[model samples]
Target: MQADIYKENGFFLDEWQLLEDEQALPTEPGRFLVSLERFVAAPEAFASLPEIAILVRAGDDVTVLAPHLDRFTMVAIEFAAFSDGRGYSSARLLRQRLCYHGELRAVGDVLLDQIPLMRRCGFDAFKVVHEPTRRALETGHLAEVPLYLQPAARPDEQPAGARAWARSPAGLAR
Candidate 1:
């Protein structure tokens, strides 16, 4: 429960608890986050629980979740490592192709430098354990260039009467 993001997102502390694989479901009957494997193992059990979130790992085909998208109230994509970029694609697919409207969260190894890009990829919340990243988020001192050159899930536009280097992702799409 360490995501420091927009105050309105209500991620200051994780309201949903992440339930790892093989872990027993809590008896308190609260919102829980479970991996896709656990959900698939016994979909019925998870379905009975209200407000369950699904965690999608890297390299997993997001399309597989299309059928069950409605069952999930939230989707957490694991980064595992900062160098791995597969999570970005997962977020995009969930948002663009699958038309998932649930809460999208970035978890595991989340870094400050990647927050903006993650946001563009449709991640609105983050579970960052990195100290530096947490500090940066708390201080609202993100070192972002604010000039993306590639098209992303979240559209961006070029500023009128601005330098070419300032071109946004929307401009490149055309």
Candidate 2:
């Protein structure tokens, strides 16, 4: 099937790029998105393929098979339903257990309120559901303010010990 490609800000993207299940292995070098299930089923096939990586649903449980965290360019968490928080945990695992340092993305059934939690977990990009208007993608995928300070393995942030913060002086006066 011909995938729907959205273009905005001079960039073109296959809507499936947001979903780990919908994307396919790369035919050429560079960045390639893969289905987490297929990767877990047969990761050896991808061994020869390099320079690019995959983004998959957190439920794929592919972490045990991941050879190198840097090999992946991105990891996308799939939210099959708004109530399904498995994706959120997947994001956290990618940062915690797998030590992934690529663009973590949130895909499928994304809700506005979930953005904050998604970022906290790990997702950096979002593929909002299709809707009317050209800017639907923008309105659907919102960025959270103030980068997370927790001990997370983010792409460009320092890995730290347990997150700790002293009580704010303003609150101590109370």
Deviating ranges (above 4 Å) for candidate 2: 1-27, 130-174
Give the poorly placed runs of model 1, Cα more than 4 Å off.
1-11, 156-174
How well does candidate 1 match the true structure in TM-score terms? 0.80
Across 36-120, the per-residue lDDT of candidate 1 in tens digits comes to 8777768888756878989889887778788889988889899988899999999999999999998898988888788888887
Error of 2 at 130 (Å): 4.5
Summing lDDT over every window of 10 consecutive residues in candidate 2, give the lowest-scoring window: 2-11
Provide the overall lDDT of each model, using Cα atoms, as 2-decimal numbers.
Answer: 0.79, 0.61
**Residue pairs in steric clash, candidate 1?**
none
Q: Cα lDDT of model 2 overall?
A: 0.61
* TM-score to native of every candidate shown: 0.80, 0.60
lDDT of 1: 0.79
